[model samples]
Each structure stands twice: as C-alpha cells, then as structure tokens.
Target: MKQEDTIDFHIKRTWQSIAKMYNEEASKYDATMATGYVLLNIDKEEGTPSTSLGPKMGMEATSLSRILKNMEERGLIERRKNPIDGRSVLVHLTDLGLEKRADAKQAVVRFNEAIFSAVPEQKLEIFFEVISKVNELITNRKIYLKEV
Candidate 1:
C-alpha cells in the first residue's frame, strides 16, 4: 500500500501541520510548542511536581528537564521546594509564564473552535471514538501481537 494511504501517515501529517502552526504562533512570544505545552500542564494555583510534569505532558524526564531549564533561564518558570514532598520540586509559573500560558490557551481554544465549526458534530464524535480506540489498542498491546 502507498504511504499516503496508511493510517499513520495521515495521523503524522496532520500532527506535523498542527505542530508547525503552534510553533509559529509561539515564536512570536519567543516560545516553542513544547514550552507552551509545559506551561499549560503546570498547575497554576498549587504548582505541579517536577517528577509528574513529564508524565502529564507525555514527555521524557530528560527532555522535560532541558525545557524546564530553558524556561527558567527565560524567567518563565520557577522551581520551588515541594512543601508536601521535600525531595521533589514543584514547577510554578512566573508572571511571564502565566501570560504566555494565556496566549497558548487562546491558541488552543481557537484551533478547537475552528475544527469544531468546520466538522459536523457526528463526524467529530466518530473521529474522537476512532482515536480513542487506537489509543486503547496501543495501550493494551493489541496492535503488534505475534501471529498464533
């Protein structure tokens, strides 16, 4: 089968387009797609644990560490001692980070609104169902089982 006709091909292509669009918007504020994502995942009130930030964002610790470092350098985030857990740090957004996070949130909201407006409700529901099932299959190790 041609690559263009594959399921993953379309998924990846769509994701790349979305990522590119988000990155372009983020660049105006000197941020990147990952940074915006991190900002969004962080708890605005109590702060998020550093250890849990990666899992929340589906990111690796090392990769997240680098991003967190850059964010710190930019004064977008601050790492504080976790009051509940001394061994772990909590990531809190600085004022600048909060502003950027608002921008990121608006961008996401706009994208979702656009997609929702463009697609029929029933089709969007089916698309979500298919995507959920795809995730379920992967999580259950059902995608690559050995032949009987």
Candidate 2:
C-alpha cells in the first residue's frame, strides 16, 4: 500500500502537526513541547520522583536529565530530598514552575476542548478505539512474524 494509505503514516503525520502546534505555543514561554508535557505530568503539591519521571513520560534517562537540568537552570524546578524515599530525589516545581504548569495545563485543556467542539463525540470514540487497537497489535507483536 502507498505511504499515505498506511495508518502509521497518518498517526505520525498527525502527531507531528500536533507537536509543531504545541511547540509554537510553548515558544512564547521559552519552553518546548516536551517541557510542557513534563510540567503537566508532575504533581503540583507533592513532587514527583526523579526516577519515576522518565518511565512515566516514556523518555530515556539522558533526555529527561537534560530537560530537568534546563528547568533547574531556569529556576522552574528544584530537586529536594525525597522524604518517602531517602535515596531518591523528588522534583518539585518552584513558584515559576507552578506558573508554567498552569499555562501548560490551560493549553492542553483548550486543545482538547477545541477537538471536542469540532469532532462528533461518536466519531472521536471510534478514533480512540482504532488507536487502542493499533496499540494492542503492536504490544502483542502481531504486526510482524519475525524479528527484523
């Protein structure tokens, strides 16, 4: 089949578009799309653990480290001793981080609202189902018979 006819192609293309839109918005705050996502994933009240942040965000250690470093340098996040886990550190949002997190949350909420307003609920449900099924196929390793 042609590239445009493939589901993966559509998924990748749509995601790229969405990432670009988010990046553009994030640029105004001197942040990137990844940073906005990270801010949103973090717990506002109780800080998130440094170890958990990577897996929670599906990011590798090196990349997460870079983002955390940049945020720290910008005074957005501060690493504090994890009371619960003595060995690990917790990444808590500073005052500036809290403000940026709110901005990120608003951007995500507005985007979802816009999508809901534009797309029919039933159609959106079907779209979600299709995406879920695709994920399941990949998770089950059913897309390929042998390791390439």
Candidate 3:
C-alpha cells in the first residue's frame, strides 16, 4: 500500500477505536451530555458566548444552536445578554447543569484514566509529543484537551 493510503487507514482505525469506546459509554457520551459538560465550565468569570460553543465542540453553529435551545427549555442552561458587549450572549449553567457537568467530568476522567493506565509509563511522553507534532503539522488546532 502507498504511504498516503497507510496514513488514511490508521486515521480511520483511530477514529473507529475512539468511537467504539464512546459507544461503550454511550449513556454518558450523548451530545446533550457534552453540551452540559461544556456548560459546567462556564460562569460569570469565563462568560463564554453561545457562538463559541460550536468551535469548542467541533460542531456546526446551527447544530449547536439547536442543542442550546433544547438545553434552554430543559432549564439546564440559561443565556443572558453580555454586560460588557450587548451583541454577545453569555451562557450560564443552572444548578442542574452543574450537577450534570460533575457527573460527565467524572465519567471522562475514569474513561481516560482507563485508557492511559494501559500505556507504558516511559513511552507516554514521547507518545504525546508525536501526536502533538502530527497535529501541529496538519492542523493549527491542538490535539488533546488542555482545560482550555
């Protein structure tokens, strides 16, 4: 096989692996759950705008907006006019949103730790470096979550 084909094969395989992992945890991996998870990080200090959510989630604006509307109706989150900028809207997590965020965070932590614990300690640093280099070369965005 050609080098390009080999790379594509690996990429597809990698995605499948991740998706399978997510499927195994599907009850916790719903997009709505993620929306709530993301909401937990928002507050008066962060003051995240609803529009910024799409870029953060790698979703289209329309999809994010629809999800946001549903969340709003469910009372998980609330949007208010930004005090600093009238044009911007800030998203705040309601009490229930915060609870969901905490649960989602614990699930993510447990899942990721399970995956990382299987890796050899000595190779972990180099593994991250290699992935980071590949991401840097192909896309300007960062590869893994770094707590924003």
Best by lDDT: 1
Q: Rank the candidates by TM-score, best first.
A: 1, 2, 3
The list of candidate 2 runs beyond 4 A from truth reads none
Best-to-worst lDDT order: 1, 2, 3
Error of 2 at 55 (Å): 1.1
Task: Report the C-alpha displacement of residue 144, candidate 2, in angstroms.
Answer: 2.3
Q: Per-residue lDDT tens digits of candidate 1, residues 26-132? A: 99988899999999999999999999999888899999999999999999999999998799899999999999999999999999999999999999999999999
Give the alpha carbon lDDT tens digit for every residue of 27-140 in model 3. 553434546446655663555788777777777888778878887887778898988899999988778777766766676788779868998877888878876788786686
TM-scores of the candidates in the order shown: 0.97, 0.95, 0.74
Put down candidate 2 lDDT per residue, 1-148, tens digits, no spaces. Answer: 8999998899999999999999999999999999998898889999999899999988999999999999999999999999987999999999999999999999999999999999999999999999999999998999987867
Judging by TM-score against the true structure, name the best candidate: 1
Cα lDDT computed for each candidate against the true fold: 0.95, 0.94, 0.71
Comparison by lDDT, 2 against 3, better one: 2
